[model samples]
Target: MRTTKHRLAVVTTALLAAVGVVAGPSSGATRPGDPAPPRPVTQNAVSDSFSDTYADPSVIRGKDGWWYTYATSDPLVSGGTPGLMHMARTKDWSSFEYLGTVFSDATRPTWATRTSGLWAPDVRKIGDRYVMYFTVTDSTQHPQGDDSAIGAATAPTPAGPWTATDGPVVPPRAAPGGGWWWTFDPSGFTDVDGQRYLYYGSYFGGIWVTKVADDGLTAVGEPVRVAVDNRYEGAYVVRRDGWYVLMASAANCCAGPSTGYSVFAGRSRSPMGPFVDAEGTSLDTSAVGGTIALTQNGNRFVGVGHHAVVTDSTGADFVVYHGIDRHDPWLAEPFGINRRPMLADRLDWVDGFPRARAGAGPSDTPQPGPTLGSSLGITPEDPAAGGFTGMRVGPRDRLGGATGLVRGTASTRRAAPAGDVHVRLDVRGDKPLRVTLGRAPGVTVTVDPRGRTLGMSTSGAGRPLRDSTALPRTSGWQTLTVRATDGQVRASLSEDDLHDPYAEVTLERDRLRVGSAPVRLSSGGTVVDNVVVTPAAQDARELAPVPQAGALITGEEFDDASTPALTWVRENPQARVEDGQLRWPVEGTDLTGGGNQAGLLLHDAPDDGDWIAQTKVHLDLGSDEIRNYQQAGLVAHATDDDFARLGTVAIWNTRQTEFGREVAAAPDGRTSYGGALVGTAAPTMWLRLAHHRTAEGEHLYRAGTSRDGRTWTWGATWALGAGTEPRIGLYSHGGASPAAVASFDHLRFYRTRWPSDPGAG
Candidate 1:
């Protein structure tokens, strides 16, 4: 729903691939240009929805022991009208009672257009009063269209009878080219040294952290850019273990099912300057770096981002954010708007990194709720500090003296009762290390640094071993956690404290024996330190398997000549279908921005139900060179100005699968366009657009792309208005520079299985 900065920069493939799961390690391990290790998947984060359509939520616990939440101006229920702002509070976090809007008609700010939106509310306790900072979508001071700015308000209680300042707290920044930079998503932070700061801005101008004056209303000194533009937004900062971590949401925040909106993190020792990812890559680079914080697993929920972190009574953190259920994506009746329900999940600190649901992404299952002074029927174990007897102490010279054993050192610790146990330790060196969790016949997990691999083997015969070459490079210290639960041993290795495990492996029971077993560590040539063994809590539940695709409705072979006239309508006679292929030459025309001269070969979409439209296209616009925007693929067109296009396009140095949309701008009759990235692109890529119609007629089109045409990666969905009927089409446009042609293999349609309520836990 928040569609500002429609022309934001594109995220490069190098940045996106940083979190992607590849087959194995890079061909050249020691090469400086080697790709980062594939991140391991963590699942089973139980989440419950509190309020529907509560986008960009900010939450804080009041002195009264109730957690109060504030959300961007949106309807709280289906077919409901939006308020000035939405607020709710819950003592237990399970049930919520709406406390009504933060601003009444008489108290709402009026320095902008009468229809200006108030969004992304951030509340903090300042001095003796609670202060809230929010985004003003337009400002009379900036007159030139959507010049959003940060506005501050004050109240005595969480459910505030608030009062806004005389003017914008952080005024709109004028862009050099005209209009204003996106000064949105206002968040407040107070450094350890008692210096207050205000974090604001979006993908348009990058996320910036600025010093706050004593009043907490106006900014002082210079603003520091913590994250680069076009990649991160909704900046939230937390200070932990002498590090200032910047967490932000990436991708389109409102793209229905295609909403790949997820949270990422970077940390720096100082409150500002040089925040980097686990690989020490700066967040302000073209090849941007960010540890994956919260991403969508293949589940009912997508677009899980724009979050707020609140610590419960027991000192555990919970991430309160918004997500759209793929099945029921929109608000009830007039359903073009995305229905982003407020959700909360446990936030765990594995090492020093923040992982939502221990890196499980979003959950659709019933999970152990947050600990608020009372036990959640689960008891957390305190890890043993130090308990190991040295066997063969390693070389004292090459291996620096760390707490744990180093190369050539061997040690064993007495294990606790069977049930479930977890061993956490840090490893270093360029050699391999062996860890035996239980006993001699227990699970043996090996960490190989030079090879960038993780191997697991059980002592029992006929029990197959498992290995993963996707382990992060171990030039520095890495955290390794091995867990044994119910006869299953799982091992995960993290690159650094700021990341989730980059590699993971699980081994089933073989000659495995649990009970009063012993834990052994053999640092073959590697170094191990900070050993901690504890009882693991089996609180996480396994998620149900992802639902499979339903029946195929139609599979167009693109071979018949008369089908182009009977089944498809060519907007222009610039393309031809011959020999089971639709050949459309690359055109110099375009459909993005203010241009709309692209040719379209259209086919009427399903008139009644939800369906999927898929096409395989071969368009090679050579990479590492500027091809401008030459692209060709599938399109769901409503008009020249209203459409959703999915194409493999050459954007600057990289080729990307872009799912972009254009729609008529409200109030102003011009068209506004913005693009969200999908998966990595290949010369021949399979693209699919899954379309669903709401009861009120809005169309939701989700984008999916595959490099091999089998394993598909679905991304953010763009919503089209119900004013016109959109026809599925194929198009070729953008400057046809370094000339290329696009050949479409076929067009297929499939029926979908609609879930009654996918978000219901």
Candidate 2:
């Protein structure tokens, strides 16, 4: 089988070279890049930050709960003076507050005089003070390894005022047992016993560890060689589960796309002894190194290396590093390689191995923001279980796979991690408004422009309860407020009247609602600016409640930068995250060869029982109206020869057609397309495939399509004759426009009952 390509994707100029297209399940034809069963991507994918860039980053979570990132001086690129470490802070990795440089160039020590410049640096918290470890060379040589030294500086807080040692803290080792010796990049380690140590070195010399004094200004013990991973630098040590994971950067870091830089790792029982990869090859014995922690994933992040790890209040870890930009990758004059911006991704320990999302590396997809948005503002009676609390959908996107709304309310109901949910929603539209709530185990009160309406509902613990009411129809910007407390709900269309005596009503439980926009009308879906669920005893914003293990499922909205629990695999580098959607363009040569299928597959074990995979897909024809049998939607594949497909399309004879493929019995199957074609005004199709066991004991698959994410119109069902479980994939193909511009607005997988809601504009 052809191996999966998770790194750089070679753009083949041979378009026609990849021939043949599978017209339907009734045919045995296959697409290009479909030779192998793509591996699942459990990879914590990430993308460039919002208009921020930095190099050689050292990230850490301070004792104060905020995350800080310190970087080496980029005078070579930013035309700034040396000795200035750039800094930034973030509550959630999604948004950051840039704090400029840490110290002035005047803080440069006289002993360290490397003309080429200061290299990798690290920061640590020692005895309530911030201690930063850095490396510098005194010579202007080609390789700045020899004559290099690791130094230290201290400050009261992470934002230092001014403090630099007179010389290199850890100078050259005279009689060190070694293979190769070059000193740079000092990774600091605060041992379990509160003692500070450092791992420093580079190139052929090998990495060594040394204990430092309590002051962090001098080395107290002799250096010893630990790992000699080939050409590795930027040594970092992570102690977890009684194992020391040594992660370092490998390969040439700055030759543009030709740069071979990637992150490799090894583990050991003790801090200074031997560490090795899965094969038991000691990092000190072999130059090739141990297991890999991060690598290139072609979608745009290239030459991913030089990284550091930090943890959230919940102890969830994320790695920050700099990587080459696939789009504008070029050596920008004297700055070495430009566009290598700071990128990050969450890390997970699978079967004892610390891996990037699904064992993959840096991805270009927009990931979910770290859920650490706010600290608990209050204390709670029940312990917080970070479950699938709620979701925020933006304009121009589908509801993903939301199922829980029945009747008018929603099926899903969850309590505040601390208190009641106080919803303050900002909305704008001219059409009449309809809101659907799937959870209302109690009474619900609604207010519209006409009058006040009330409904009583009952939902068992974790069951579905639906409720609906007309929202006050208003044009222009306005605020809709809802506050639930003790089965009583106080809601209003105006923020000023939320708590007014007349605006108060009663609701059984807290429920989330959906709008009625078709396609992003101006700004579609619903934008949530302030969704703070309050706590009665204390604020839930300050509480750093850890997430339950089961909440880390394979459901991806392409909105957060995190590793999903399920493995997601990409077949080629043609996929990307843009405008908050997972998009795969059909450039004539897709994963389905000359046909209309290019997709990324999720390797979810079918043995996990029955499931429903759903997503929102749309084809962009620009101003040109679609004319061909444009197809795009969900694909379920068991092997190279079997699978099922469902989505929205314009066929040779229909409009927004319900198009699908059923390849159950090998080379011969059947074709199913939706009969009702949606209007072209707004063309986002919500599609789902539910796998169930029939009375005959056969695992039957049912396909459905929706104009909106809620209600579903069930379509054809096919019996399985191939593999027991199939992989879920998202594909885009065959639009009259050769661009094959199809986009998946959102994707989610559910193993339970489906909920329906009203369609949004």
Candidate 3:
């Protein structure tokens, strides 16, 4: 038996290698280094937004050039309703318009009543009719141990008057040993050979595949184990480039922002059994797989899994899934309410395996759209444009005093103006206090009572702007100037301040305001004030990349002098380029001194997933005594309040630690419960971190790492919140004091798809 097992592993490795693929590190596949392919632009292409609550999303492209996405509703509100499946339509992945719930009813199913949420529904076009396959439970009981069954519905279009069958398509059964009752998270697929198969199972049994009858409503054969052997659930499948790809969800899910769920994948010649990792390890059917396919970054939140894969009008594959919101603080409650939203992201084959970019979250690049169009005047409920409330004293009364204030609305709007714009506000104060304008990218400008003097502070790597200019201040109103250019921005109190010989204040791009709560006076005073904002344009160059981006070395061809010191260029002549990738071949040198670091250092002071960052890491020394935290990974969406770090940590000799981690809001920059993992291992690695928005909440994920850049090992997974995006970078800590140098190279950043789901094998 041992010899046979060895032979099977060899054969599997050879077959995978011939396909130019390897098992992920944990799965024993070759490490992969290829970047995700750029998405083809299309008309009406829409990207996922922070407000979407898509989960277990199944997408399909119609013959009509329209793409439809079906997902579960907010689990918190669907009370006892078989988790209503919702729908959205889009031409491109760029944007989507919500359709409505696909499945909801006054009555419930027999096996699972209205209490058990409907879960993991998959949609496929069977002939001219659209068939939807899903799972529903018989009880709202905890631990999810009750009997579950697979059901189906049909509709003419993606948005359905979905009609359900009288009974489940696949009924629950006892496992071989009565270990646990078997249920389903049904997934459907059509192989190149015209074979129709349905994959289903949950934590009770590994994913099982069985042929579906031509009618598409019943199983044609007994179920056979296919992809995993452990505690895996939520199986999905898609065929690309002649290979049958299987994706599955591994780990705990459905706990709101604190859940631990991620997507994993494998391939097989047939839809059954012996699906191997890149390195030829059999997927554990009963335990979480050790390979991670997609995860969240800084702005992106929630652990994304339980997905459905579908092709778009152009035939590009896309994954749809739900994630929690990073900005919605309410999701922080344990066992309280779940608010994950459905999201979608494009997927592609890299070296014959499926890969997806991190989904959009609160902290990634803002999708290019019309900045919050024309403002509709201020209201007490507007987050960006509103007045103060709940203050011990108002802005004017507490001139030199301090008080508490909360941002009125939970949202923000962008301002549009013609030229250099001036923002004015009404003040009622006599003491000295500084007025500050807040903006994204952490931009801030402070104006003092001596209107002639202005000071500025930015989170990125730009010089501070300080100048003196006269400003208009009446007993009732005060106005401040904010300069705007194509990309850069400069602020001064007046024309006199702009002309000051020493006043060479220049900021990048037009001015934007950071949405802060109502301004306060000093600690023990009262004040009342109304903020008035306006915009004008000025001549200037585009704003430079924020100090965060500039501080790190991306590709070998890019560098900036004005960038900050978080990253540096080393002097190793041996560091050369290979196949358009940077390679460091030198050995045995203590290059850990300041400025000699191998990877980029990020100092943007963590924010959320509105930003994303990537860099390659190479480590030479391996030590069993090395601290478990000694590893190289990506740091993103970091703030003084909350942050997430994802990457590979070489633990003790036993295993390599894959970090899919998050730091939630804590009193002193610590997580309320510490970080969690999607999976772990000890090996050379490649890591990606992302934040995504969903109906339930914001989510974060971390894909595993590998050596030869082909295979990988699953890592950590965690949640940040909802509606908030943050910052990103590369991080290395807790190893040797003079930490063994970890070389990072070939970094890039791009906008990712939202509500990304993992496809099935």
Candidate 4:
């Protein structure tokens, strides 16, 4: 059976403070940054099996060794197709065997969208039964005037004899136009202790993470608002190296060829808090998240969204999603509008996030196979378009998936006969076969199985040429390779010029010819099961990777604000540089969406690579009254949800004392603050945040402080973030008093150094 990527991922913390959930351990798992050789993937975009298109594929492998993909797509067009939910399965992803619907659409719940059916569905096994969470919506009006529900159902196996529940698990809240999308799109996630949590929501209310019953039929507690951003949906959660990663798709989901769907990501040590983006900005019920995974390739592909991930035996994550077919992007009359095909590509980790197909993906090249199986569903057409004119041939199905058939016509002619040209087929009929190049300006060639010489003639606009010379006929099959290169009927028999003294002719141009009269199969005659046409040249070449990246040691001494023009980006234009220093005048600001942080001066590091960002903190309140939690210091923020902090002086909200060397971590999903506390009273302090790789190939982050900018004492180290690529810089916050101004001096960053690294020169 296929394994569920979300369920199979075990993100267990050592101890849960609220529920006391314990995390177990494992081995052989390499760090994401480890430079080990890949497990060997053959190619990308492997799902090209069905005659009809498949979209929004919910991929999970059953324990039965078959990769079952239940999609929000149409039913299979075969005689052996299965019920309501369309399903296609294969041992590998290549040769899919379609099984009919799992349940009837007539069973739509009372709260469900009538006629619209299911939008997003996720199924996972609990105990001996499979529980599926689905979004009941009218897709025709999705993200616009649509109302939907997140519901549940259960089945005995993945193949399903499913029983629908009576009502919606997460009912639809009132949706206002241009407001938070508070409905549908549910995902079932299982933690290390087998605890099940349901994550759901749309662009309206953002994505919410809630603890669900082990049966996955009910919620256990209040849902927590975790992530938000640009038309977000399809909430998928996974755990890697002690971090709960949230992945979602950006909107314009089904806009035919004009769709702009892509994956955005955010992470936290816990499954819940201030989930942020790459630039240290926290996402809330209204903001866009950070980074991109897969996106539009080029003109050849579009609408790359509504995705799901599956891991192989080698622990590699391959994303199975849908995109509009660029060749026939829009469907013709009677076939709707879009042709969304299921595609697969391996996920690559750069810095600290996932990049699809090494980031050069969504390609149109003839990629290799997944190497997990022997069959390739994408086949060339039979009796190619160039083989002859006026003939209709089906696609190649060498695996016996189709019936071989061919048809054409012919016209009576004295000169080069037209209508049906030659059919370079392996099929040799019971009788002699004749082929006419064309009439008037056409040529002709004929062959008899019993005859020795092949007859050839031409009666066209050019000189009439005719020949009936006895030519040897090969046994078994005649492999004919003909090319209209210059003017001669250059058959693949000899290299010499096709010139005869008795028959001399030349063809200057070509017009539609070949079949001149209708022809029928003598007795259900056979032909090649496959045919293909070599298209004109395309720029579908594979791109190479850049070997090494340039090292970054960027710094700003803050000597002249007008000269270097501070490299930091201001989210608030009011924060400006003054008197040779970066000044953030906080009139009332918060660092995250959950309201735990307050302050507004922030900056980004040179790169996402490993680095140590440090700066001198200066506060010139001029004896004015200060607010509690009013702090200024050096910050190393990987994400707004997860980051390290060090303040020269932070007034205690409870003790009412200014403490120096303040440190903490803003959990992505949880409400609790994390980090070791060190006490001190100082107006000005030097701060630094360092990150480096561990012996086992993981990342470690630490915060340190210095009194005279020389004597330093490093704080406790934290190693909980799953993403390694980081944004290290400085930050300041104003709590209680909104009109607080924080300043920084001589901010600089260097390549990260570990406890084991040699000192720099």
Q: Which candidate tops lDDT?
A: 1
**TM of each candidate vs. truth:** 0.54, 0.44, 0.46, 0.44
Indicate whether candidate 1 or candidate 2 has the larger lDDT. 1
lDDT for 46 (candidate 3):
28
lDDT of 2 by residue, 602-631 (tens): 646345445677788876443224355556
* Runs off by more than 4 Å, candidate 2: 1-53, 76-83, 114-116, 139-146, 174-180, 331-336, 373-761
All candidates: CA RMSD (Å):
16.0, 27.3, 27.2, 25.2
Candidate order (TM-score): 1, 3, 2, 4
Expressed as tens digits, the lDDT of each residue in 1-761 for candidate 1 is 11112221233222212211001111111212111112122122212344567889888755433568888888777778888888887655566778899887788887756788999999876645678899999888855679898999998776888998888888889877777889999888765334678889887878898998865888899898887766779988876545788898877887555566878788898778688865566777544566667766545677789998875333346788888776676677556678888777778766566777666556676555543231111111111223455533333322224234454545444444343555666565776888775445455788877776788874443324465545532344566777665435677764322222346677553222233355667765565554545445332232222223568887677777656432433355767778889888888888765767777877778767878888999998875576878899999988777888999887655466777767665333555465666656678989888876666667777677877877765555566766678988788878866778899998888887433323323
Question: Number of clashing residue pairs in every model?
Answer: 9, 68, 190, 53
Model 3, position 247: C-alpha lDDT score: 76
Give the C-alpha miss distance for residue 600 in model 1, angstroms.
13
Candidate of highest TM-score: 1
Runs with alpha carbons beyond 4 Å of true place in candidate 3: 1-52, 73-83, 92-99, 107-111, 139-145, 176-179, 229-231, 255-260, 285-292, 329-335, 358-363, 366-761
Error of 3 at 183 (Å): 2.2
- lDDT by residue (tens digit), candidate 3, 71-152: 6545323233324766777654556676766665653344456566676677776644678888776533334456677888
